[model samples]
Target: MYRLHKFLWELRRNPELAERFRSDPDQTMRDYGLNEEEIRAIKGKEFRKLYQAGANPYILLFGAVHMGVPRQEYYERMRSQS
Candidate 1:
């Protein structure tokens, strides 16, 4: 989660950097400790599960970080209603 936070921070500060990383999924998986075969599995990994894993949660990062959506939006959209 901490790593995800840091990544989100980076994405927010410089989304171009995020795009560069995402551009090469190969390097990204390798950096995430996936072996060749494991990388292949990652290629098949569902995008939603990736968001759930939260290690390098790109979906949230993409919206909250890359899109520069105000924190208020996150609050309104994500705050627990219960």
Candidate 2:
């Protein structure tokens, strides 16, 4: 049920919304161990960066925690940080 790639790509498309999450992306970036700078850096890149094979660990974790992944999965991924 997780269209993980599509959802992440959408987040790539919409950066302002991404900024809203920036203050605390860590709870989402938990398993991947990404920090705010890397999260902001990845989002700050041009659109082409989304298409690159270099999947941002932040984006991957963000989608899994915020958008496409299941609510249960979200809670599981975020519980400790919560």
Clashes of 1: 0
For each candidate in the order shown, give its overall lDDT on alpha carbons.
0.49, 0.46
TM-score of predicted model 2?
0.25
Q: Write the per-residue lDDT of candidate 2 for residues 1-82, one digit (tens) a residue.
A: 1233444645557675345446655444432445554445334432233324455556555654443355565445444322
Q: Please report the candidate that would top TM-score against the real structure.
A: 1
Q: What's the distance in Å from true for residue 39, model 1? A: 10
Clashes of each: 0, 0
Question: Over the stretch 1-82, how does candidate 1's per-residue lDDT look in tens digits?
Answer: 4433454456556657557556886785456455565345334433244344554544453535353455555445445322
- Residue pairs clashing in model 2 are none
